[model samples]
Target: MAGSSLMKSRFESFICDANESVAIQLVCSDNELDNEPHNHAIKEFNPEFSHQLFGDNESIFGYSDLRVKLYYSSAKLNCFLSIGFTDKVTKDETNGIEADDVVDTIRQKLSLKLCSSMDEFRSLLSKESQFIPYGKLMDSFSIDWKTDEKQTKRHFEIYSADILVPGFDAYHQRMQTFLWWLIDAASYIDADDERWQYFVVYEKRSPNGLSNGHLHSDAHNTYCFVGYATVYRYYAYPQRIRPRISQFLVLPPFQKCGLGTRLLHTIYDFYVTDTAVFDITVEDPSDNFTRVRDFVDSKNCQKLNAFSVDKLKLGWNEDMATEAQTRLKINKRQARRVYEILRFRCTDRSNADEYKAFRLGVKQRLNAPNQKQILDYQKLEKLKKFPEQELAFIRQTTIPALEVRLDLLDKQYKELEEEYQHIVERLAES
Candidate 1:
């Protein structure tokens, strides 16, 4: 449900491409361009016409057909906009359209000056800008990453729907558009959904702070948008709520800086304290997300008394199930999975006796569904007794299949362990 306040602004119709595949990227800042005496605009919107356009690292990749790049300033004064189209799409054979026509269409939509030169672009920005600042944030925190034995701190903030209300806020809508470029399959959600929550990470810096450093302003609480996640609350049985993480993204600039982990842990902290929360879940998590979640969950589950090395060896008991569900709000199935992982970590695979016990334990669970089939085969066929049927099953189906399954499971465990190790290493560093 969109609120009454959602209205079109100056940059509303900037995207001119009819193809949904065309990506629009924005690099914006809130800092006033007071020092800059001139504005900047795109001289050439053609990508392949020039060698290595937008510099080496800034080039857009993976799109064979088309791409639209936008660069603009969101300062209090002197707003500037630039538009560019990739060369592959400019070819009539490839795109079935004229590149110049597409660029013209975008220019018409943005209603800004076109620049053939840097000086001209800068001159256009010298004029007064109509940039409206994004709204203030509610809660914030800082996470630090170490570089060359030095710690660098990043500031992040959390926002609720009420704080960002009345649903149609300009920043909220702008962010939805911005997210579409970076997040695959990104779409706008109902801001009116009371169960939805948002978290944003920003690269904040004060006016006097170093370029891209933390801003020292108490008066202006708006931080430069870095990355964000959207979560929805689901009604669980027995008067509890399950918060399902929906879309998660950390911009390329802020990625690999350990902010994703911080953001996820922050969400967990938010829900874990709620009296009505049952457990947390994620919706159709990607491979990257699965790794992050597994790492976070394994760490959290390890602290529970029921998940200790000894308790884990005792197998998945009610204590493990009950404590994980009651205290950590983890579901029974997930709790059991976590228990197995922790137990595997404690096992010394080099020892035959210990390793055999571990394999037997896992195999018993793996073969559980086939137990009745083996019994039925023996009883109905009457060719052999229970022992003979079991032996035949083991030779024909069970052992061979178990070998393949175990190999796959071991590989998965090893991969998960590697991912978990990375998180733990970062946690220790941070």
Candidate 2:
């Protein structure tokens, strides 16, 4: 009974749709309250538009005259009341009503068909209870892609110029931090899962860390070649990719910049070249079809199929079977299981873990040789320094402050050393 008030409030909020002309009111009264005779009112609004726009019936170019009947429907209002509570108010004492009696009276009058059960009518209201339409869900989770460069730089900068493939220690630290952030955000949304997973996009970077050269200077410049080791393993063969991309959005300031596009292109190049992958499959939130389509088109890619789970069993073909087998070879049975889990069942921690394990396995495979080469190169490069570049960077950028602090510390150390020597000499004389 305590929750009845909250339910009533929620029901009242549901009636506030502008398209539907409906309103509900509730009143309360004491047992001794004198009540007036109840009367319900119904009103219907007339349609403003006429059927003449479609032309008269049996009229060819309005030449033939024919009679037509067009009845346009409009919004209608209705009121009803419930059966009176005889225990609370006697038939002779109808002049005075209790709060329960009033509610019962309203509910009875509201019932137009006495033969129909109230239980059946109550079932109709259940349809309106706490449901989100598919269209609304799609609209809320749409992804927006940008083609501009200046915009992308505002959000994510090139933190590292060279490969800087995160070491295992660093990767573990970053992965832990990333998991914490994911848990924190998911908790806010009351999501069921506490685990988070992502696929790492490994590719070559340009010397300057710019994917595309100066936007204005090079219209037909030779764009950098960013090859993918195994596109299918990195980008495709994952279930969460679609929902993740849909809900994962870049800020407005990051749009129109080449960052998103470049990142995608890098992945695309990897799939196309290194992996020889012709088709890259992406699952996008239903709302992000436009963004996904645009990205596909920009990369000269084509949509192979709009995948759904039921089709896997009922409509499995030779081509799909072969592809599934290939995926199994690369990723084992886990890949197929992930597809099945994501397609038929609700996304949960198990699916996330499966996806994460598959990804880590793929990355480990690719990085085996690449990781060794990177570590060896970094070790050798650390010994060499470009004095000119270092001086330029310190003078042109904010590094001068750091240099100034070093100079002050050097001066203070020298003065302290001199004072210590004088104190030592004084002690010797004494």
Candidate 3:
């Protein structure tokens, strides 16, 4: 028992949490790279995943103060990976459990050139000036930036699908390597596929530090990635294409600063303008992304005549969905959601009749699926003649069912109203 306890305690010293052990930094300038990367990691953050790179335990044994520093040149995303530890448990000290192959495992996940040393990565970073963004400049805007001391307007640009340009896929891959560090379920998309498209946001970074205004000149603009979204244009059978957002992330250094919202708004504009596109969709969006999407869609719909205060109070209408689809490319399901949000914004909460009408309108839409199911049942051949016995049975079943559904509807409506209220509150703030 004494020996067993000693062995367990000894192995515990070897165990290191992979999530904490790994560190990522976006190196924004040459000065940052010239110095030791370990100390000056600009906005250091840990990856959401360690298992995908480290293994089942999501830990690296045999090391203490184990920090796997992964640095990248902010503009070019030139990768520099270094595995450091204060101590390493050796074969002589352990009872067979081995240290995880930390370096090799991470290298396999990234296809880009992995510079093993700071000097080598900095050598590649020197050529950043030649790295022009591949796609047509889609949009550029300046935002007010603030820190502990002062405030200045920072500039950013969004580019449409870089993979479409010949020979530029390498740069796109370098950019995507950041996703693995941020997105929990991140995976590479087939850049070769025509169906996959990308929208990337790059900050016109000043090598000195984030400085004011459009780069002293467009000719002198040095870009670093802020965030990006992957869109897959799926074929809608006979004609038209539906673009679904597969991945989205505004790096930890830049989130909560409206960069995600800006990127999403720009992508929406990209699809809404494309005549071949049907409607925008998302593949398993996180709750955070859904809120951003809701805000953007609702904001856009509010500008349309069909979703105006007058129309929203009149309740949900086909014209609301129709205009949203035709003018903005919002699908009916999403349009209905946008309608509810906009209606909540316009709802007269103080008036009893107005509030009741609003609830009834929302409840009607919520009950739509159940109503359709009943209509579908009535279409059965045996029930078509409306037999008295069957009618009686349906009535009997429906009374309780309706009661259950009503209770459910109220609960659902309350939840929806709460969500819409949050979105509306955000809309006001934004």
Candidate 4:
């Protein structure tokens, strides 16, 4: 027992949280690449996940004060990975287990070319100006974050292009590596597939006239890659396509400035006019992305005649779905969701009758799967003795589970309301 305890204690000493140990930075530079006159790293953050490279435990067993510096040039997205540590637990002392080969693991997982020397990295950084954003500029906007010296309302531009764009596959490789660190369950896309499209966000150094959704050549302007999204064009039956957002990510330093919302709006603008597109959809969105999506969808739905105050009061109508589909290119499922969001936006919680009606309507949608389960059971009975059998089934089975589902339903409703309230708050600010 004493040996076992001592071994465990030694093992604990080596275990380092991979997420915390890894440091990522966006290195920004102007004409002076030889010497960054100031701190060259404009933005620095750690990974949201590391288990894919560091094993399921997300720990690296044998490093102290580990600093995995993975820096990328802001303009070109060129990568440089450097792993450093104050101490390493060698296998000789540990009695058997070897320390993880950090660089080897990251090289395998990220599939990025690592810089062998600082000179090589700076060589790539020197040529950063030659790197231009791929594809056509689709939209542009500015965000204002205050600094001690000035209001840093930086200019940003979003571009949409096919994966086939010359040199884009290479660019995508470096950009998609960010997904491994930030997006959960993230994986790379096959750029060779013609159906995949990319929309990228970049921060342009220029100050004004960004609202035009177009950028003219300004030698003075240096474009820095910010965030990006990937979309897949799935074939809808009988000649239409459904464009689903496969992945969306805004780098940590750039988030919470409405860049994501603007990015989504640009994506919508790209497809809404295309007759070939059936509807827009998202695949396995995380909670944060879902809220952003809901906000965009509800706001778009609000512009339609079907989602007017009176129409919304009427609640989830056929016209709402039709208008949302043909005009906005939103699918039925998302349209229904937008309807509920807009409905909840205008619902008067203070009035008992109005509130009860809204609650019951939402509950009906929430209970649909449970209702289907009951029907499924009924169907198994050969559809015989419908009224009596259903009553008996409800009494025997549902009566016990009803209390549980009711409690869940209330909880769900509360969550939904809170989410809607947040959307409404954003909407108001916009």
TM-score of each: 0.63, 0.21, 0.87, 0.91
Best by lDDT: 4
Task: Give the whole-model CA lDDT for all candidates, comma-separated.
Answer: 0.55, 0.28, 0.81, 0.83
Give lDDT tens digits, candidate 1, residues 63-168: 3344444443223212233334443333433234333444554454334444555355455443313332343454566667555646656556654443345432
Model 4 is weakest, by summed lDDT over 10 consecutive residues, at 206-215
lDDT tens digits, residue span 54-96, model 2: 1222111111111121110000011122332112223333334
Of the candidates shown, which would achieve the greatest TM-score relative to the real structure? 4
Q: Candidate 1 at residue 9, lDDT?
A: 25
Q: Model 2, residue 164: what's the lDDT? A: 28
Candidate 3 C-alpha lDDT tens digits along 269-289: 888888898898898888889
lDDT of 1 at 404: 65
Write the residue-wise lDDT of candidate 4 on 171-256 in tens digits: 88889999988987988888889999899999876322222333446664667788999999999999999999998999998888
Full candidate order by lDDT, most accurate first? 4, 3, 1, 2
In model 1, which regions exceed 4 Å deviation?
1-67, 72-81, 85-139, 145-151, 162-164, 167-169, 209-217, 220-222, 359-430
Instruction: Please list the Cα RMSD from the true structure of every candidate, rounded to 1 decimal place.
Output: 11.7, 31.9, 4.1, 3.8
Give candidate 2 regions above 4 Å deviation. Answer: 1-252, 275-278, 284-293, 298-430
Cα RMSD of predicted structure 3:
4.1
Judged by lDDT relative to the true structure, which candidate is superior, 3 or 4?
A: 4
